[model samples]
Target: MHRVRVLPKYLSKRLDRWRSTTFSENREWFSHLASHGQHPRAMFISCCDSRVDPVAMFEGEPGDFFLVRNVANLVPPCAVNRELHGTSAAIEYAVLVLGVSHIVIMGHSGCGGVAACYDKCEGVNAEWEKNTSFISQWIEVLAPGYERIKDMDGDRSERLSAFEKEGVKVSLENLLTFPFVRAAVEEGRLVLHGVWADIGSGALFAYDGSTESFVEV
Candidate 1:
């Protein structure tokens, strides 16, 4: 027989509170969403950072964005392999099935994942890297940007900040490597956007293609 444990007391309390305040207050909206499948306009790819709340930052409502979060907001070049690729799968679904008009890769300042790449460059072991080592593999997507930024003149902090933005650009490029994404973008069916969040000041900057740089939004 299978068994299921009850939610912890604190977690149950939290759930009840959320239901009362957020869910119950919008029961009709939630019901409509449950009846009709989601058709979000954008796919928001962001880092798995607690402080980086894509919905709140963008003032998005439920079903507004097809969201995918991962370390450093990294998106690997599309590849077909036996191994399961969760991020790529999300991208495929968002593009092919959901038909999201835009894909936004949002990176942020003081990102711990980006910091880990600097650690790798400095030959320092990130705590998670030592035990699982999968983190290193995942962070590998940002490796090229780290290599470019690390050698640049400036303090380590400045280099890391530059890398955080560079990581967004890298992900944007990687998105193009996906055939479906590339086709959609080429045919004017979709748009690719790169954004960086200044976590401390709550400011967002978007990559401007003409300048090849991020500008304040």
Candidate 2:
């Protein structure tokens, strides 16, 4: 196993304090959630990056949102494939079972997976790509944004940020691919949202339904 460092005395103390105090403070809510089951109003599909936690970003408590995290936060259209179906399963449960009224696809800046797609990393073999074929195909959603901004270069950071935001819009569109999700939206039972988080600045931007553009949250 890759061992993580546990040095830094001040950080260690903070961790200990969080474990002891935070766990105790939050345990009651956890118990309540387990007893009553989740009654979340929204389903959040977000990136698997440690820095982009949906619960933390939304200031949500347990049972507040049905959450799904995956590479680049991509939601594949419901397919018959028997392979990994974690994201799809979560969406099914959240929408069909839990009856969440809103579905939010949250993407963020400084996304390694998105960056890899944009850079077109070499040395990745065909077999490896086949194994992770879903990721490769899903990341293609951002191709338009990449094509638009490939030449305009001032800061790589800014360009990547734009790509990340664009990816959120792509995911929002992807959510409509599922028939159930589409029906729900058509009936006004569910709403879809795109959100972009700025990791560098700790700022959030959400797609405005009226403007069809990302605005500060």
Best by lDDT: 1
Candidate 1: stretches off by over 4 Å: 1-5, 126-132
Steric overlap count per candidate: 0, 0
* RMSD (CA, Å), each prediction: 2.1, 4.6
lDDT of 1: 0.91
Clashing pairs in 1: none
Cα error, residue 213 of model 1, in Å, equals 0.6
lDDT of each: 0.91, 0.80
Runs in model 2 with CA error above 4 Å? 1-28, 121-155
Clash pairs for candidate 2: none
lDDT of 1 by residue, 1-217 (tens): 2587888999999999999999999999999999998999999999999999999988999999999999899999999999889999999999999999999999999999998877886777656467468887788888888777777889978988899999999998899999999999999999999999999999999999889999999
TM-score of 1: 0.93
Per-residue C-alpha lDDT of model 2 across residues 55-149, encoded as one tens digit per residue: 98779876788888888887765676767677888888888999999999899888987786676533344532554676676666556667666
